[model samples]
Target chain A: MSLAFTRRALLKTAAAGAAAAALSRRTAAQASGRVVVVGGGFGGATCARELKRKGLAVTLVEANAVYTACPFSNAVLAGLRPIETQQFNLDAVEKEGIAIIRQRAVRADPQARRVVLEDGSSQDYDRLVLSPGIDIRFDALPGYDEAAAGTMPHAWKAGEQTILLRRQLEAMDDGGTFVMVAPANPFRCPPGPYERASLIAHYFKTHKPRSKLLILDAKDSFSKQRLFQAAWQELYPGMIEWVSLSSGGKVIEVDAKTRTLVTDFGRHTGDVVNVIPPQRAGQIAQAGGAADRTGWCPIDPVTFESRLQPNVHVIGDASIAGGMPKSAFSANAQGKVCAAAVASLLRGEAPAEPKLINTCYSLVAPDYGISVAGVYNPRNGVLTDVEGAGGTSPVSAPPSFRAQEAVYAEAWFQTIAREVYG
Target chain B: MARLASVLTMGGMMSVAVVVMVKTMPAAAQGVAPPGATSCSGCHGPGVSDAAVPPLHGRPSEEIVAAMQEYRNGRRPATVMDRVAKGFTDEETRAIASWLSQQP
Candidate 1:
């Protein structure tokens, strides 16, 4: 047969096969097959919504009934926005014929294609999407745990703890110390702890001029460090202090009860302690053996299928998609791509692996903002960085650029929220 | 020979479809390439010089790939490029970059 005939025949056969698989659902609801998505954050939410739109039966299991986003949680910590701004009900997702389960996923039986819930309930699926977000490693840091969080609020999850940390800031006396401990790299939102520190400084400048903010960082340098340092010097000098990992800035232990954080250099007492501990894949992903020693799941970039198991896809922060940072935008993009691949798989077609996009925005101050964005692609089982794809905040940008950045920050938040929750 | 011409035409059309799909789909679906490497020329044109977009002629492959990646994300801030770069795999990025870099 001619090559033309061969190509046409292949396309026809593939299309027919896909159609048959899609239409061969066991039940009326399962005609497109069952897709159980663990976690209702950016990645899971986007996948669930898109898969549902594609005529798939989606079941989204989340630990919290209402998702309090970590995206805008910084505003809550800085007292600029309320916690309600970040709180979202899963009503929209549920309305899309998705079975929203409000319970923690305990373990996943990859071999059996089933997930076990904290309530001892077991659910089955033909394909599963896991985007369970991040889990804090309390044990990684001595004297830091659930008990420590009571006094030293991580505020990383961004809900009640954000408010608690904010309240602690409010009650501090003028000239009181606000200590922030930032974790090393490969943590959720590389720019988060720095952004939090910047926002707090803004608050101090306006509300408590005499107050001081000290950052105890685990890393030697930070994302957008030049911009952050420059802004801090220009806007809030003497009001903020940053100690690097080499400069005795590392936190060795914390006495949460006394609000004292001990470092190699010395011990310091804080009126408010904001500790963002080291993070890993959410407990469910780790427990399922989807995660590796690095505390994240390894997946085939083409299909987002877990490296450890067949027929299971891990997306978002849980998946070690190299070169793609763990951000809401990255997770959202991965979620959609993975959903398409999953849908294609059920239809007995190969998933089309696509490029991924990520952009992270930080509020350097109320009117000033900075960001980094990149496009990533998978090569040889690793996501290689697409060089020259994105750049850091422009050096010495004009006020108008900064002002526009502030507006874009708001718009970007709304855009991602719509993409995930709308 | 008629069959060969028909096959080539179909390949061209599929390349266009892939470009349209990559450019128009949301940022997540950008990097996926159609079955063969020939589809690249459909949008890029037979080398950068012939394409509607800027010719990739003689540019460093790494630089070209970097530029595409930037365009796909909001960082570089190019409207058409962002659409074009979506859903690309790393291997595909390198392949396209190498192809454009090698074009006369």
Candidate 2:
């Protein structure tokens, strides 16, 4: 089927379902509407659960059968966590009576209120929630493409690619160089790259003490720089090396077959290279005209509705929520809030504009963790940061606090996992 | 009579101290803004540039609240913003929203 016809049919079906549900609830004191959510990650999953709990019929779509988290996938690289530790089934959410469709969304019909599926089937909804995490813009990086990724893994997606990178690390001999190419900003998990480097170093410290690690970063300063540096100095000094943008750390090209990473400064060859390229909103956003020049969807903060499309909402990593960082937790929170607004609108009531929360924790080592938190609100339809609303992990903290941070990090993972899948 | 006066002075001093100790303090120390509102302009104001960090003034309050709430709730994964929002109350967030809406 053509993409256009598919979208129209989906929208028509949703409108008809909504009309029938509305009539059925006319005397029931509550209205029913179908809210279809794309991407079953942290953002989409939580939003689906919230909508379902609020008495809305929700259909959740995901490209994969199981959910794997990138937050602690670093531990997978370090051998601290087995791959299965980060894997979760959607059984809990399925038990909640949410209609689950294990298919990737190909396109969104904003006018028709339907999502086109990879299998050529489509679903219609009164409200659509999109939270597909991110799209790796490999073309943005010279010499890096799908074919190149096969040779040099960009394990940014946190599933099979993660294991592939880990296996590559395991195969390297002592004194071998492990190269990590950090992506530009506006990507998921700001602290992820640093945490990943720290964990990989941990692996080499015990197994291959003479081996070295090099990080070529696109940005000058990174999240939790001080804390990460302090931890690295204390734990594994002279083992991990970082080159920043000012020092010519930005990777301009790569020869994956040769395992060489070329920065403006010089070329460095490594036995294994993990290159994370620039990112943008997921494919569905680009297909729907929701993406901007920067490749992220612009939305009205109050409604999460696409600025270009009237009834379609974008959430998670796919939306341009300026001043807001994309994280699994952030996406999940936005999903719930978006669900609330969508449900209220469907009920013919004005949606309550809401405050949002974001918190990110990065484990510097097995025993150490640091985090930052913030509360955000909308101003003039643009998302703005709240002042004095959030801060970072304390520096030079006592042992008790460090230990406590580690405990909190684990608890946080569990909480977010449940919020998304359950 | 002098002795009696001294006793009364000491007793009153003790009473004041006890009362002060029992009184509840606000969530954050003094000179702080309430949650979700004008309280954020303190550090996020102009003249404080953290590289690419954008200024929070003159933006929409609805977006501000959602962003703040996103930080506080861990929906947005930021390092510093999340910690700052842990101190907010829902009512204070509304108050902050009101104050931000009136700003430029």
Candidate 3:
């Protein structure tokens, strides 16, 4: 594509006139209220920025100075892209007039409408948004804890763990086996494990042809199973193996010392073991009483307001967002809707009915991609997919379509990054 | 300084030109977006110049309304739009078209 049609070009045009106009109008009508957001990932950052743009007093609290995105971390693992490319700074968001507090939020006091930071400071808000992503339930899997993570990296959080796993792959012998234990459903990035398997297989194809990848999945099936299976068969036949739960694929425990995985059927040893454990709402959500037995926060689908805590909202992976997956794009979409709703509520007006959209793209290979899209609205207090609204890429599509989707996937990442961070 | 002055002058003229142009078209409700229209902006709004996803701003209202009606009725072959169009009522579609048409 031409540079003139890139995401940056479009952003310049949109921001120069349309967005400024919208902001001025919003400022004229909306009442200013303090909105505090915890976590500076896709959802929290977007919420903070959007609220600020709409003339709200906004503050964002984050533990990290930079965010390494999870969306394309699989590419980093496959050696297709460097991990540095996935890291983003907060310059753009800070420039937008949202206060950035580089501190860990330890607790939320809903009654007081404030978030307590690790430094003993508290930021109060008329409205609070929690987008703390997910916390790995290390106890869910025996023998898999922080210590074990050093040897068998989950690499799901997309930072140091990603580098560790990549190094493990590099050190493995040509004929060695790499075992991956996929997490159960409701985890972040439903199609991620399969995509990682495909990319790793691609890596082995080019670098270590004799190497084999074994995917021990906890779920019976996964997102884009057929598409992934088709790509595996066509691209890296016999190099990758996938075992489902019914076939004794669920990993019950691990012996990190021996680098062995224990499943219901048998124990298998590998040169490298990557275990993605079960997940729950980030600790702050649970501590704040926003999450329930399911380990996810329940919310009003219309405004993403926490059902348990008044005036507090949850978005991103930590929330039970009906049918939406815990992807970066979904978080960004929910952030915008929540911002609009909060802006209206601050003005003492009823929140506008919201419509949510999501599109997740997974690359099977460098030039081959697949996607799923959906449009959703609140129905019976839960977000439900609009009938016949969105679907996945056609299985019978030509190679060119997949190639185009790969390009579109990159464009989407660029556009969403600019939208949320810049 | 001269270039900055020329750019500011052009920007002022552009804003004036837009006002005059919008005044010529039949005036619609100013601020409110249609109930379901904001969702479309996620993909089709400003800063998205993808050929596959057309920008919705500055389009003729009648043309947009006609296209949405066709999508809703299954006359348009769409990957996703047909289903999304069905979510909006005809009046809602017209409202969206009217609002988007007025955008710069």
The 0-to-1 C-alpha lDDT of every candidate, in the order given, reads: 0.74, 0.74, 0.80
Model 1 lDDT tens row, A1-422? 36785565455434433443343354345444788899998889988997887778777887565689998688787889888879776778876767776667899998898899876867778898899889889898899999889889998887778888989998988888899999988888888888888899888888888999899999899887988888889888887889999999999898888888899889988888898889898998888888889998999997899998788899988888888888887788788778878988999997775666676778878778777766666788887666655556677876756655665576567656755676
- Poorest 10 consecutive residues by lDDT, candidate 1 chain A: A15-24
TM-score of each: 0.77, 0.77, 0.85
Q: Write the per-residue lDDT of candidate 3 for residues A193-289, one digit (tens) a residue.
A: 9889898898999999999999998999898888889889988999999999999999999999999999989999999889988999998899888
Task: Residues A1-422, candidate 2: write the lDDT tens digits.
Answer: 36785675455445534543443354234434877888878778878887887778777777566678887899898889899989876668867867777667898888787788887877767778878878889889999998888888888888888999999999999899999999888787888999998888989998999999899999999888898898899888999999999999999999988988898779998888999888898888888778889898999987798898777889988888866778876786687678778878888987666667677777777877788666677888977776766657877876556655675577567656655664
Q: What DockQ does each prediction reach against the true complex? A: 0.04, 0.11, 0.15
Poorly placed runs, candidate 1 (over 4 Å): A1-32, B1-104
Off by over 4 Å in 2: A1-32, B1-90, B93-104
Query: Which segments of candidate 3 are over 4 A away from where they belong?
Result: A1-32, B1-45, B48-104
Tens digits of lDDT, candidate 2, B1-104: 34324533543444343334324323222222233332243223322223123334334457667766886787764435557756566566556755544443
Among the numbered candidates, top TM-score falls to 3
Model 1 chain B is weakest, by summed lDDT over 10 consecutive residues, at B42-51
**Model 3 lDDT per residue over B1-104, tens place:** 34324533543444444445555755443465555555554555343433234556556688778888887787754444555676667787788788887765
